[model samples]
Target: MRAVRSIKGRLGTAAALAVPLAAFATEASAHVKWFCAYDVAGQPRGLAEVLCADFEWLTGLALACLMLGCLAEGTPLGIALLNALDRVTTRIRTDTHLLVRVTLGFFFVSLWSLGGIILTPELTTDAAWIPWLQLGLAGLLISPRTTPLVGFGIVFLFAYATAQYGAFHLADYPVFLGVAAYLILTGLGISVLGLRPIDVVRWTAAITLMWASVEKWAYPHWTDPLIAAKPAMTMGASPELFMKAAGVIEFTLAFALIWTPLVRRTSAIILAGIFVSAVFEFGKVDAIGHSGIIVVLLAIAADDVRAAASRRQVVLAPAYYGAALAGFLALYYVGHALLFGGPAELTGMPVI
Candidate 1:
């Protein structure tokens, strides 16, 4: 009975998390939106509320990890790791276009098959046209000449979903826009601002992860049911502490995605592993929903672009991470407060 309900829970109407317990292992593990009603415009937990002692310690540890990763970037082991990664991903790097198209082709086709889904499992729609649009997008991926059309199609879908669901709710998946940009830029064979298509994708993926991590912090209670249902996920830690550590780990690793080559590639690989690991626990919903980003991460992992890393850059990474972390935290909390009202006292775990 427990297993049956768990399976049904994954397929239930997507909302948002609402508990004070252990949460999803990674941002991609369980979209809080999938299982419970979420008041996106509701008052979020204030920054003051979330800065508990545990949060402070976990953050400090995360900063240490970032500083160490930066130092390692200039070491012999880092160079060797990069070389080994390069050798393994040679074909993937060379055929990034094919990989993205093939992955997206299947992704859209799956959406078409599922029907009613906007972009993921939780965000559903009644419009009959949506599945057809997804099907059309899948068809568009078959030809390089038509790939630009596919990009435009994705933009339309994102815009339409934003209109239907509101921008804040839709904001959870900027990765779609990143995928669109990659398709459009690669298809058109033009470089805007001298940035490679893959680099654009990498940046957007980083942004998406960081933003979701903030959601984990602001709405830790939203995932309490998930934690309660899957207590083993907490690894014997209290649910609240587990959620805090998860958020810090997620945020720190996400920020690393934009660091030096060694750091970013390693971050990509670790993130990919985390997402994949989630599939075993959450099953097909996670696997299908996360497939596109997984492919993107693999491409990033294989990318051979060696940006010249100097001592100055390595020395400044922790500073950048701190700034980015502070900036995102402010954005999420203040944005919610301004859009909603003042922070309200959180109640008990919400009944889904």
Candidate 2:
């Protein structure tokens, strides 16, 4: 009984803590590149600088939330939450593939209409064939028989963009590959490895968001001008602190997407809300760019089958979150250093 009460109390606390995090989440999903000046080749801030005291405190708080959330997963409240999610998402759950297809079809058609875009808004091209290719891909989405081909076309576009830009710049959008994989696997009626089509999309979306969160940490200065332009977005916090907190919140929620079923489903709902809110604040470019992942998150929220039934798995979630956090941070810093020379030196405080 005490254990049950403990879990309930922790769940309530976690829910309360989540409010402040969500308040800042709009900026977390707003594509910084769309509103800010960025250089793909420019050096990011050093890891030492990013891992400062404030960052450590935010990380600690995030970990606490993760622990509480994981513990809450075993409680009756968690099961109730999942049931509520399932009830709310009945329509989306019934038409998962249709949702993805229609969204992607609209997205591709919009891209075709826009013209001169490579894959995302920030990545532009002078090639005349790309818009027509987008149009062709949109046409392919008209039938499930040809949807897999649309997937292949998306892969080609991603590859072409990588060739035009560098791999590092393209890394910002691996969710494209996730969308492609979803289209391919769903159309073919097959699972790759052990994961279903939507499973692949869930994992990839988590990776994409986590990578973006790391970028916020490494290049917080890149978004300084953006915060300057839209001071209201900061909600009274200094831009520097806001960026750090946003990175932590975004990374933590992204990691939650891959956790036990209830945790991940709730996270998907929250992330989807964040992205949707960003679309409102950042407008059409945000909507167009984020359309694919938003569909994936919706699918994840509606997923009822894939789950961690083992209590032990839920208990170890914090450990997994910590290790994954460390691993991704290492990879982001080391990979950038290898690809784009060393980190930049800052003469003074970098937070504007």
Candidate 3:
């Protein structure tokens, strides 16, 4: 009996650490409630499985492909970016700002070409709209010389198109509207704030970071397995509802950071720390394939932080696959599944 008690104690201790780690990994907003299908191992109310991808899913794919290509051409892009940074860092080394702008223009043309090829019709039912909308966002993010009117026209045109098509769905409405509103409001906010061009770009990136962080916070249950009865893992499990609580913390921090300029950099760093720790603790062996963008975004956030501090801004570049977004995101979700098992099982819901 004494031996049995000792073994039980050790088992309990290990499980405790495992649960929270698992919960947080899959807890990110971008991945949350994304593609949960009826095939989901128990009978948790899975989303209706559609035959083809929706606009959002297609947009995500385009964003992914765009990022992948950018990473592939990392050397030139990085050099051009570095030169742009040099221009920003000081007044006069050489009058090569126009060259950097020209380099970015070429990148944009290449982006359009890539979007044409990679955003294939097979992936999305709403194929007509997806590339166009994503391409618009890409434009705003890339050009260091973009004006608010140019951005406004691009975003508004897409918004008008979506409205014309009446393609909005209940599940996607909030996020779509929210992101749209963010772009418009921020445009106005930048005008009011008298923000520089680079500042607008950085703020756009920062807001996205903040929103992504807030997403997980809003749906903490997606990650928490201890919100399970069997409690497969410890870190993702909750002895005292820690996952839910942490959700509150992350959500609050993300929101606070988005609205407050001074806190934005700090918020980006905090969010990055949270994501990196979550990845290390709970990400699975195959995480690299899926969650790569999130990781790269964090690294990009680091650049934003430094830029904000040094130059009071960051010149936004077009979206690119970045170093390892898929890998990182993939690891995170895999960890969530490995650690948590299934939502219905955790919650004691009868399996379908």
Candidate 4:
């Protein structure tokens, strides 16, 4: 009994450490992309379309299963499955390599530079030099000695560029804020702060998803064009129904991230899977946009945190977090509509 108790104590500590790291892995708004719409005559006009590709129905099904699993995580069957996952991830956490970290850093930098993800609007054909600058940053990330500084620089530059597009518009893509937070936290985690990088990543992921979910609730019409383009997205339901359901699912999963360890990891897995599956349909842009989220998810999956108590120590109760998020969304959209006339008015910029 004493030996068993010791083992349990050690496992608890391991799980506590894992909680912070696992927190980092999650999808930034489930890898959704927004683009300006155009008229038949090729004139850039209308609100941006919330688009998805590559078996959206299947993705939805998977997310549903994930949600169900999260709800059942306290059950015996769920406990068994989570234990199995924990065992597998335990081996992985012990094997994290520097090469892998550098590679991920390089990939993100490349994506940013190539205009495959964030900054896509700013790094247009006219601004050729921007890509070159991003590429230079990518090169800097390849070295451990320089990774921290380069990461900070990248985040700062991204924030500056994002601000140029209009602070109000920034609310539309809250995932970029998550990305920026990840870069800053990772850099600080590596060099200056004792903060766990994965923890920072996880919080940003949750915050981004929760924030972006509001867009779906406040402006479901933004997704109408994407559903129209790919009728299969509706799965026989009306576009409005699909959009509302998707918004709820995304928001719930984001909330789950702060709920418990099993649910958080499971949500990250499902969210990452949805993002990855979309790459097959949306092509390079989807892949580039989601790469950072995927890498963070991978890190979370590999984390060996198994402590149940650590999950309870989170900042807010699930209900409180959900309510807070809803309140913020209400204020944001209502204020924007009152000021600009409608949410669609904010999307009047030209396609990049």
Q: Best candidate per lDDT, number?
A: 2
Query: Residue 292 error for model 4, in Å?
Result: 0.8
Off-target runs (Cα >4 Å) in candidate 2 are 1-19, 306-311, 343-352
- What clash count goes with each model? 9, 0, 38, 4
Task: Record all residue pairs in model 4 with backbone atoms less than 3 Å apart, i.e. clashing.
Answer: 15-306, 23-202, 24-201, 24-202
The best candidate in terms of TM-score: 2
Please, what's the RMSD in Å of model 4? 9.4
> Clashes in model 1: which pairs?
14-34, 15-33, 16-32, 17-222, 18-221, 18-222, 19-221, 19-222, 22-239
The digit string of per-residue lDDT tens for model 2 on 177-282 reads 9999989998899998888888888888899989999999888999887787878888998888899999998998899888888878878887888888888788
In model 4, the runs with Cα more than 4 Å from the true position are: 1-79, 90-125, 172-195, 309-318, 334-352
Residues 182-201 of candidate 1 have per-residue lDDT tens digits of 99999999977999989999
Candidates in order, TM-scores: namely 0.88, 0.91, 0.36, 0.68
lDDT per residue, candidate 3, 113-158, as tens digits? 4453211111123345544554564566454444244345445544
Q: Model 2, clash count?
A: 0
Model 3 Cα shift for residue 159 (angstroms): 1.9
Candidate 4: C-alpha lDDT? 0.55
Per-residue error for 277 in candidate 1, Å, reads 1.1
Model 2 poorest 10 in a row by lDDT = 343-352
Better of 2 and 4 by lDDT: 2
RMSD of each: 10.1, 4.7, 18.0, 9.4
